[model samples]
Target: MQWEIVVGLETHTQLTTESKIFSGASTAFGAEPNAQACAVDLALPGVLPVMNKAAVQRAIQFGLAVGAKVAEHSVFARKNYFYPDLPKGYQISQFEIPVVQGGTVSFLLGDQMKTVRLVRAHLEEDAGKSLHEDFAGQSGIDLNRAGTPLLEIVTEPDMRSAEEAVAYAKTLHTLVTWLGICDGNMQEGSFRCDANVSVRPKGESKLGTRCEIKNLNSFKFLQAAILYEAQRQIEIIEDGGVIKQETRLYDPDRNETRSMRSKEDSEDYRYFPDPDLPPLMISPEWVEQVRSEMPELPGQKQARYTGDLGLSEYDAVTLTASRAMTDYFESALAVAGADKAKPLANWLLGEFSASLNRDDKTPAESPIAPELMAALVKRVVDGTLNNKTAKVVFAALWEGKYSDVDACVKGEGLEQISDSGAVEKMIDDVLAAHPGPVAEYKAGKEASFNFLVGQIMRAARGKANPAQVNEILKAKLS
Candidate 1:
């Protein structure tokens, strides 16, 4: 019998507030160790915590974005735990009641739309980091991250495969980034995921023992880890061995997972409400204010691109994957107009993407202006330049040395030769030089026609318009 994989994700997204969650300390990344920590962050004596209003507002904004119920009131709880990174003996998080609950985030897998139900998203403070190196027989602590605000989003186990899990993660990442709540930089730990995975018989109603994989920071690693862990569990069950409920870590080098420790349940943390901070309250007016400020989300934009702009679903998704990319695409389309959307989409997805990848830059960092890109697309569509010539112009624009697409085309002499008389003469010359192939074409050798077209293109130094050349060749040869 086939085995089905079940997966759920708990993502921790660090809020983009200017200050720590419960302190006035700066929440800047990459600061000197202990530099940004305040008395409250250090948990020093005689210091009390105060909630940052901006952090609370951000959580409300996220709740609105995800269509969740923003609680009128939520309490802060102390999750008691002992760790080297945690300056305090307890972590300030929400328990018993969270800020947002019972939401759904919809994403597309191929052509089908799927919605993953959200269990809860709560407000919490992040712990500091422990550095093991650069200290002789001693570990170092970086309190810069202490007291930073985070939104712990938990999703129900609605995913059935590794692909679905990765897709869901990516969709969440895009939504948060587009909403400007989080930067979604997985490498910087701004966005992190802990995946709970298990396996069972294809038609079974009961789930097998599930293993939790922690600290997966990349989408590729998340997919790989879940795949490996699910297969491992299935194999163990098949061999008469039972799967263990434990925490594991993904080793990217070996493409495998190793046991870290037994997984801890909610009771292990010994949660209790914190006495220091009061309950968080969200007013209806505050929720309405944040909802008004939210920009158009990715899913909405994708639908508009497909229905209004007449783009394919694949094209719409590709264009709306990132906010910057979507902005670039729309700006280019505004100049290119609706009639040129398909060609413009092709250029943006093809040459524009390729150039950005080659330069190790993002679409946001691209030096090419949308107007200039629109001009290049116009030239190709209007037959002022061919595909090869447009590529040359694109390179010049990417290099930042050229002022505009027209100047690049003129400077490189890459204009298309559309003179039908000139093209016909070239075609005749090729056909006359290859009498055998020309005779073979007349004798029903269809492949010889392609040979004649190549000869014509070669003779014209690739500047000839391919379609015009084909038309001229067919008329002359026949």
Candidate 2:
């Protein structure tokens, strides 16, 4: 009785506009509760909603980035519901027709390329927050987030595992943030994910009863919740129990899900087009304007990196994982020349990444400037400094003790002993001083060669290029 897991994700990304989607109220996060909610956001009497042009433009930009079709015409509908935080008693959202449609999100899972087909993306207004903390036996409503513009992107049930689903979510996060539409900040509720998960017998054509896991804010949590929910459903089916289609919440402390309520279908909302808002229309000229302003997206950059620059697929994908990181790599390459791509990527993805994580920093907050990294990479390639000496140079750059790589090398006295004649003299000195090891090497004890090389480096005070030292040692030993 082998079972397979199926998953689909619906992500709500808060747009980067300065105001709410249907009102001019400020969208700045962390304001006092209910203070920022204007008459329109508050749904006061005699107030009418007006759509934000900037939010729409951002949605268009996303559609273009993901290769989705931007709908020329769409409609806003009122989703009838009862909730304490929903001031309007109904949410304004796109129902029958959405702004964007039919796109695929591709990302790497390990070395394999995985793609998730998107159903559609629609523009919607976010509901306010219901606060339970800091109140004694009573609840509070924070209307500050009311009317905030969100782009709800839905996907088909094309994912087969938790890893694939998590990968899809991460891929979408990268695309949205790269497009500059959303901040992609899970901590601030700017980006949230809901997963619909089910389990069915292997090779079965019929889908199993599905449950929706609500509002997983972090990637780790998203993966954990899906795995837990899938197991829960599989266990129930194996135990001769029925799986109910309900909404569940992941309890991070317990690492399980608890049923919140039954899942509702689209008809349950009783959706109808709003009379106050006309049919939303988009112009080709506007779409073209957005397309023109778009920067090279991640996929485009990945292709160019691999095809034009001759980088490996893995290196290209790692380099283009984020827009800021790609910008950093390009800026470094600009200073160091494009030929340095492989080594530059290695440093960026290896030591540089480790340093960033150690310091709990991002590429934007990195102390090492792009130009400085380029200079460091150039020095390493040219034998001006080896990896060890370059690390000392990086420390200086990180501390701002030196403004240039050359200055850092000079300040720390890390200049490589690359002079051929000088290296030859040091190797000769080592061979003469270490006669026993030199004899061992000449007698076919190949392991003694490394000892001779180490002796030469020590004679040169660790400044000699090991490659040059090895060459000079080999010549002397012969």
lDDT of 2 by residue, 1-478 (tens): 8999999999999999999998989999888898889999888999999989999999899899888999999999999999999999999999999999988899999999988888999999999999998899889999999999999999999999999998888888999999889999999999999999999999997888899999999999999999999999988988999999999999999999999999999999999999889988999999999999999989999999999889998998888888889999998999999888888998999889988889988898999999999999999999999877887888788877989999889988889999999998887777778899888888999999988877777787778898887777777678
Residue 229 of model 1, lDDT score: 95
* Number of the top TM-score candidate: 2
Clashing pairs in 2: none
Highest lDDT among the candidates is held by which one?
2
Off by over 4 Å in 2: 432-448
What lDDT would candidate 1 get against the real structure? 0.90
Indicate the worst ten consecutive residues by lDDT in candidate 2. 468-477
